[model samples]
Target: MRGGFCSGGLLLLLLIAPAGAAGTERADRLAFEVPPGMAPAAVAGDETFQGGFTCRSDAGENSAGTTACRSWISPVLPLFVFRLAWHVDSVTAERVVTGIWIGRDGASEPLQEMSGLELRMAVPIENAGFELIDMDFDGHLDMRIVAGGTAGPNVLYRNWLWSVDEERFVDSAALDEIVSPEFDPETREIVSRWRSSAAEGGVDVYAWNDGVPVIVHREVDRFDGPARCIRTFYDRIDEELRETGTGSCG
Candidate 1:
């Protein structure tokens, strides 16, 4: 599944716009093809659980010359939450989601659902923040490390932490402290952190202990008039990490 965090403006649109409308109008619709031999009921019903997590079809439509679907699951507290958004071609029936998955516990594996498929990935440490990136250059998908968090006003920092791939979030730190100082993928560290003055945004880092991923979160607030900034962290507990290391030592 190809996906990433929603930008502040987009996030607002998602929250306020009628379900499935923004997705059909703004997102490029894809041809959603069901695997051969799979039952039509597979994508039916309001919700289904794949690999121990729940997947739900939050909304759907066929009125606007497009078909759309959305799904979400709360895998962990303050980190490791999964969300999926798909816009399907009205004629071809192809689908794609702007997927979002976070593991608040380092030990828990990441849960994901995209393109009407689901899978699990090993994540050794609880993430501060993560965003979907086309890392392999396959145009398939990859995850980018943004920051880490365990708890506290997490929604405010979601965009800053999980929205950018390399430097987009880092470049805007002065505008929001919830931004991690830096992201070094080779070193697996998100360093040099500041805090938010607004009540809604912050950052946090988490790691595993005794095979359990621990969570830490930081928050910030930027009162840009009526426009408020918020960040959040979520962790997954079902998946476990296999190695030990520190992310963003600073």
Candidate 2:
């Protein structure tokens, strides 16, 4: 499952061990990298191998609109990263928003949205057990945009988190009003907790367990609609990591 949010202005603070710290006990720090030849997937018919459909790009009046494409690769062991681009009529080209989900192979069912806005952004996917202590302790991550465009000053977006066991999304959560959230991996009983709000200004916290997110600690945040919190947990059934083929982004 995935945790945390990624945006242009959010400050991501990862806990790291001091210069010469020892093994395991030493604090684990967050790291990211982009491997060579990593590029967006090629558009085929109506689908892109990276899990994008109805993908199209527009370059205004300058050029013919092209297809939006994406590619995913694991730059680090167990951490998958992706890069995406939309070729709208050749001249009008842009990258997909940076936090959208592209594909999850044998991991979990893809998080689907009703809006046509593609869930093809790139974000870090780490194994559960990491904790993000808010530096401000406001119990939430800093303000950031997860997806969607802005209307004047306020932006519209959707935030999602899932707990996966094997290849199923056992639990999930989507928010239209939440700005940011932190994941606490250190908590033994409760693996992670998400703090969010409603359009009417109601705030709530949804909690879940580590390995068995869907089975245990199934709770929802009651604000307006059906409790909108989805949770899923992962177990270390397969410890070995495998790499997948690279996509050509022409």
> How well is each residue in 71-121 modelled by candidate 1, as lDDT tens digits?
111111122334333333455443323333333323234333223221121
lDDT of 2 by residue, 1-250 (tens): 2222111100001011234553223222111233455433433442212211122222223321122222231111122212122212222232223222323333332332122233222222111111112212122221112343333223333432322223211212333443333333333122223333431221122344342222222222333355443322222324322222221111
TM-score of 1: 0.21
Clashes of 2: 16
Question: Highest lDDT: which candidate?
Answer: 1
Stretches > 4 Å off in candidate 2:
1-79, 86-116, 119-145, 149-179, 184-203, 209-250
lDDT of 1 at 39: 23
Error (Å) of candidate 1 at residue 97 is 9.1
Q: What is the C-alpha lDDT of each candidate?
A: 0.29, 0.25
